[model samples]
Target chain A: MAVRLYAASVLALDDCLLSVMDIPGVLDALVMDHLSGTVMASGGRGEAERSAPALGETLRVTMDALAGATHRGTVRIDDLIVIADDGYHLLHPVEMPFDGPLVIYVRLDLGRANLALARHQLSSITGRLRG
Target chain B: MAAVHTLLTGLAREHATGSLNVPPAGKAYLREGRIAHLECPRTPSVERLLTAHGRAGGYSRAELEFCVAGAVLDAAYFLLPAELPAARPKFRPGECPRPDTRLEFELAWLVGECARRRAQLAQIWSSAELDDVPVTPAARLPGHRATVSALEWEILLSSDRVATPAELADRLGQPAYSVLLAVRRLAAAGLLVAPLMPRRRGRALDRAVPPALPQSDPNVLAAVKRALEELE
Candidate 1:
């Protein structure tokens, strides 16, 4: 049988604080500003000291670099998914009506979570939060 | 043109699938006749959204492709039916490569949330200057906590008398709908002028330009004439 995973969604009313809390082995979730790299919201351990504003700045730099590399004039990323040794990092961009680009980020345990299942769950979470 | 509102209603009824390109404006991708994803040239793409958030990283080209393929399907699943009125039957495709019922449910939920946010923003804009009124910024608004979105701030600071919401969207690289929403919101917040009646073409411009200075002030006119005669 394939490994199964659970998913949850969090809605942060404030800027970058959406909480997709407690999805089985999933550790944390956050919303960040892509243009400024500011972390709007987050849940779980080790996220206490994360500077949202700093992160937002980093994202802008990253975007600049990516655009330069691709020669695509200008580029904005929709989502970012990363698989590290310890966990999987999923970033989903939520395009707000009146704001610069915004996104939700989630980190999940690799050993205990299913990547496909998590992605599906995140997609739903995004729909609910944005819709 | 029939107008976007009318077109959307027609498309909603037809349940049409495929990408609808609005020429130089943008495109909406639909599946089985429902809007699955929308891409306005002025707004960021889905991939850009993800990378900007710091989620997926350090993947080879193959891995990126694999994830994107899955995301496209995931986005389609979430977006299509959500846009349809609740009265309609929600259809699910039979053959998904990776079958995960829970995943499907979650995707739907996220899409709905995003759509709702979009709607809220739209409501805010609709109440403002983007409507039939002349596009003018407001003098003030209430609340110390009145946080403006980036786009909103840009619109507020950059708007001159000439540019409408759609024109601003093009200049600022934002979605036209989003710009319209922001403009409306500004109006509702009393940060914009009420919509004005359509002007008579060039008349508005003519009025806007400063009239040439009077040939002379009433007193100066006679004095100037006398001085000219003496010089002659």
Candidate 2:
């Protein structure tokens, strides 16, 4: 049955999210629907409820503004990084073949997070999650 | 309804696993008291929204989870605000809807999300009346060049001035709330025909009604009597 198959998928996604949380200094991680700003999966923090829409709105506004500035009809965003005083926020967008795009949001502690290393690992995890 | 919310909260407390059937709206599927899925007639189901457009078959694990989350939220937005019907909500112990999904949400969290979504739509547009009426595009854009989202573009193209946002949502295979939000944004952008002003009730008669007079002063009573006479 489809339900049985879906349960396996859920476990896989949860494991994938666990890997996201394992990245050093990550305060939280969320998989967000780009179109509607829904939080698909969340781990490592309790703020996913509040963060999903705010971060999603930020990404949407940025995407729209950047696309306008470029005079391009459609713009593809790879990663959006925001460095705050207390933390680092990374939004990586993945385009799905059959559904609306998904954005992976991770909040990292400024003192403990390595910007370069976190980005590299996130990219690898995203590649696997996408497939 | 508040009763529905209370029922869900109670169910969560007991760690009840079953479906809560709210007729004329839809049902909520629970796993260990957490909401696993929700379906509402006003919104698209996960299967309908994702697979109905001939894009069926071979969804990645991530994609399935993503769709379920989106669909659950969408259905909750429509279902949670409804008034409880005369028929009491039935709880079928250990009953699972077909194609059960793994995405689960805390009851409190889901309710808060629905409230948040309601507040969002209210902030974007002042009225819910527009949601049910046919979406009518303006004769011209508010300006020569205005920014529009991809969904907005689709809505504009699909708006025949006949289909309401709900109907268009079903036809376009998009979540009903998303379509409603986009329509509201279009209205805010001056891209849709303005809705007619709601008719005001008779105010003169309302003002003419006398206030409670059991303990009123005689002078105030005289004024009230005179005012009542003037209406005649």
> Which candidate ranks first by DockQ, i.e. highest?
2
Against the correct fold, how does model 2 do in TM-score?
Answer: 0.77
User: Tens digits of per-residue lDDT for model 1 on B1-232?
Assistant: 2333234445556765545544333444544444444444433333433343243233232222222223332333223333323233223333222111111113333344345545555544544325433467755665443445456678887776666564454455344444666676566666777435544554422232222222223344343223222321
Candidate 1 chain B minimal-lDDT segment of 10 residues:
B96-105
Weakest lDDT window of 10 consecutive positions for candidate 2 chain B: B204-213
- Please identify model 1 stretches exceeding 4 Å from their true place: A1-99, A105-131, B1-119, B122-129, B132-134, B139-147, B195-232
lDDT of 2 by residue, B72-159 (tens): 7788887776667777788999987566555567777678767877887888887765676668888887788777877788888988
Backbone clashes under 3 angstroms, per model: 66, 0
lDDT of 2: 0.70
